[model samples]
Target: KFAAELGRGDKVRFAGSTADLKISEVLSDAHAIADDDPDLETLPSSEHALPSEPATFDVMKRVDQKVVYEKVLDELASGGTLGIFPEGGSHDRTDLLPLKVGVALIAYSALEKDGLAVPIVPVGLNYMRGHRFRGRAIVEFGAPTYVNPDTLDSYKRGGADRRKACNDLLEEIEDAMRSVIVSVPDYEALQLVHTARRLFQKSPNVDARDKQDMSRRFAEAYKQLVARAGTDPPQKWLDLQERLLAYRRELSDLGIRDNQVPGLDRERRHAEAGNYDGDDVLGGGRLLYHIVHLVWVLCLAAIPALFLNIPVGILARVYSDRRRRKALAASKVKIHGRDVVLSE
Candidate 1:
């Protein structure tokens, strides 16, 4: 439907579990070892039990996957575009899940089939609380990567070199995806990053998309810190989280938001520009500002929230919450599956 609207309907062919044939889904999430590289070695897989797929997925896995594989190859062979999730499943984690190796195999197979390089473009669908109403998302696109000619040549050698080629290509794909994603240790860390972003913001007008770069950096740094600290994080990090959470909670309790905090703009300028001449604390001016701010918020945010809740907001939330829980339960990798529900 979207393809037709986008005017690429003729050029795109979508694959699916049962409605269509996706080689990866048909293989029961198996790594595509059976594809032509006779030397491809089977690696240990699924350290944790994977989520249960729909009944159709189980039934589809029993069918020969070669036909679907051929269809994918034929699509590529004929210069058609192919879009795949690469993970072969939906996930809600802050970090990138382990990519299913099927995508790499498909690329390799397509290259070997016709001696043509297949381009893999990594796309990141980053969202801010995607399950919520009016949640925001950013579609970030990375540079297109192609299977290395050397890797293809090595794959043709049909030995351990073949396995190395496959592994190398898979690693490359993962790296490309990682380059465009904002990955943190967990949801708690993500929220902390958001709070920090809000406090450090130069202007209250900054939206989620505008802060994505800062958020990405914070996520990367925090993850690295967590990795270095091991089981227990540094006390300073914990203290910072505690303080930030407390500040945010206080803002929530008052009818004031982070943006509306008294002297927030003044402090932001002082901190960034190193100007300390002006007083950070406002007395009566602050009270007057907040009084006006509170009324404005009620007229804008609160009223709409109440109106939306009455019709679709609460009901959609209830259904989405239940679906999120179910998705989280069945999946090995998904942390919350909130994004999955929104996408669904």
Candidate 2:
């Protein structure tokens, strides 16, 4: 219905699951893989399952994860844009999960093997309400991040080189995402996890406010370290600091604290004037309330039955269509300007 409304014709692209058949046709040319395989012997059983022979299960799980990681890395190296939820497969209200190192590993391998730079773009899909039609959604596209080839070489030589390189790339990607996203406390903590991972790599002792803060500090430290170790420390460090500071400033503008990260206030009003608890069932309840509370909903819905309804509906449709077209037009008006930076 959405595609028909947008005049997209049958060009829909689906990349995720079997349930999405219509869109799946568009992904036929892309390399798509399931995020997890519970049937694999090497994969670990769910935590709810009773413990089995420790040695056997441990070995199998390690092998399974390794195989999956390696397969993904190979695909990316072969010039395929691989998509995996860095947060694994959680559908909770949380912004993100602790990023798996698999993406980082693939990126590092791609750069090392082909001298190719793969851009990891963090896409944040915010739905007004889950599993609903005519709800507003915002898909935020972040900047592409490249893995430093020099860092990969060091990781390749070390005992835990692959793991380290993967973690590093994950941290970089997380930081990039944070720069573009509107900060919510829960999501911020997830970001901190990446920061913590980076800092813990440098020194296990230093700590931040929470996991998210730790991740941010760690990313900052890594950026500083990278600059300091470069040929021109002052210039590189300044540039890096400016970018980081800009991100921090944006967070501040949104009233998000740096050290006092809090979870998302569920009671807060949504931009679309809808309630979203990140649950399909809860969303249904909200939908019911909206239907019951708004008299306009019933009046507008009854237009098709009235004698004059056709003209009224046509006028409403035309006005709504014009408003949308104007919005799109206004969004496309971009200003091109030049800036001159003078260094004292």
Candidate 3:
């Protein structure tokens, strides 16, 4: 979406998944090998495991690494935008994962060459529903940081101590990322904290309209909550947390959101059809105006509703369900940093 900002013909290189790189070769080799081996047919069960030390897998991994790293560095040298996740893989984790040193290495290498100053841009992607179709997402970009020239000088002197320089840059990158993304303690805490923020943290004067701002506020509130519940925690905080937890559960069970509850917002009440401002019934003229407005809206909406395709809608839903299932299955392999799966 931001491609327009770059110069014409400037290439953008994104981090390709290791699975995507190896899946084709692995599948082909595995299929051929399985077909050739008569023992595969005689296996006790279809779930029987393959050999752990497959030569093909190891060779492919090494080749992929070399090719990816060289391409990344080469792109940087040619003034192309090299965008890498640094997290290695896409897993659903609330917190940022340990970053790989490839980005730092690229920056250091680029700076070593004359007339090249690599700027590492920290971008954070916050998702409202990661696994759902057409889910809302916000992209936050932090100020660009660079590898310290002094750190590079030290790195040159300590030839074997590249780790220190990489560590320094990575630390800065992590700090910058934490500011843009919401990193809660865990899934349960995330739900409660988000609910608390939505219900109690918004202010009319403040610019908390965006989800990112609200998330930052939520994180701050969470920090304060934790601080208040230090070694000798207060009972009130404990009680409040319990209440929030219960509220989350109730919302889940009822298949509703916090914003849907009446009286939650004094200025308006939200319904499935639309929002009510409570001034609609103030006077006869106002009531007539509301009726006319509702009719106009219905008339405008009828055009699309009348032409809505049932088959197309069904196909869309089916496709979304399949995609969600596939994503869920792929994400299930990693239990530690699974993405938060929710519906919008």
* Top-TM-score candidate index: 1
lDDT of each: 0.68, 0.49, 0.62
lDDT of 3 by residue, 1-344 (tens): 22222322222222221221112222231232111322223223322334355322212222336677677678877779978888776766566555766788778877776436788888888875766657777788888887788877866665446767777788888878787788875667677667777777555344423656686778768878787777877888788889988888888898987766754555453454375455644675787899999999998988777678666767766766665566655542233322433331
lDDT of 1 at 137: 73
What is the clash count for each candidate, in the order shown? Answer: 0, 8, 2
Worst 10 residues of 2 by lDDT: 335-344
List RMSD in Å for every model shown.
10.5, 22.6, 12.5
Predicted structure 2: lDDT: 0.49
TM-score of each: 0.65, 0.37, 0.61
Q: What residue runs in model 3 are displaced by over 4 Å at the alpha carbon? A: 1-60, 64-80, 131-134, 154-160, 208-214, 220-234, 248-308, 331-344
Model 2 scores a TM of 0.37
What would the per-residue lDDT of candidate 1 be over residues 246-283, giving only the tens digit for each residue?
A: 98788888868776775776768768996544344465
Candidate order by TM-score, decreasing, is 1, 3, 2
* Highest lDDT scorer: 1
Better of 1 and 3 by TM-score: 1
Q: Residue by residue across 269-332, what tens digits does model 2's lDDT show?
A: 3535675556966888899889787878777877667756777767766665565454433321
